[model samples]
Target: MKYLIPLLFAASPVLADAPVVENITYSDGRFDVTLSHGDTGWDDYADGWRVELADGTVLGTRVLAHPHVNEQPFTRSSQIMVPDGVTQVFIRASDNVGGWADDTVPFSPN
Candidate 1:
């Protein structure tokens, strides 16, 4: 028998909302981030994401080149060098239409 798994994808046409950060993981000096957005077309989509410190300092950024119409809640990775004394960081995702999300996902790389 063949089994199938379900995927969570929410595609919206409203351009007033930002992409949501579905999940994130940290390893060594890199982060694998998953984001979900209502990407109708090229005019609006999840354009970028960034890693930052508690003090609002950005460490790294991953920019989405195009719309993920079929692949909602997509995952991408990027590397950021944390300072010697830093223990944790936060992630913020943005869309071309709505900019950054209201809440941020916190992560600790220890």
Candidate 2:
């Protein structure tokens, strides 16, 4: 799946909205990241989001299905076991056509 997301998005339009990290909530060992993107439809939508270490270890990912056209920006959470002493992680979003958004959301564990 890691190699497939980018290829899927690359086939779509280039003008699609980039996904943005709007909010993050950390509890215990889990996190909830809110993503904002312009979801056009099945052909163009925010496909997924993930939390990873700066070194590129993916902690968790939220897979989105269909398009949240009416919702505009939406929130979703992924639960993962974070290692002890790891204070921060990066959040990334992807659209069907645009692959990964250019912005990486940096979040600190709370």
Output the lDDT of residue 26, model 1: 83
Clashing residue pairs in candidate 2 are: 9-96
In model 1, the Cα lDDT at residue 24 comes to 83
In Å, residue 53's CA in model 1 sits off its true spot by: 0.5
Model 2 lDDT tens row, 1-110? 79899999999756877788889888877777777777777888888988889988888888887788899568887677678888888888888888877778888885
All models: lDDT?
0.85, 0.81
- Candidate 1 local lDDT, 1-110, one digit each (tens): 13232222234344468788888888888889999988888988899899989989989999999999899879999887788998889999998888877778898878
| Model 2 weakest lDDT span, ten residues long | 72-81
Q: Each model's TM-score, in the order given?
A: 0.81, 0.81
What TM-score does candidate 1 reach? 0.81
Overlapping backbone residue pairs in candidate 1 total: 0
lDDT of 1: 0.85
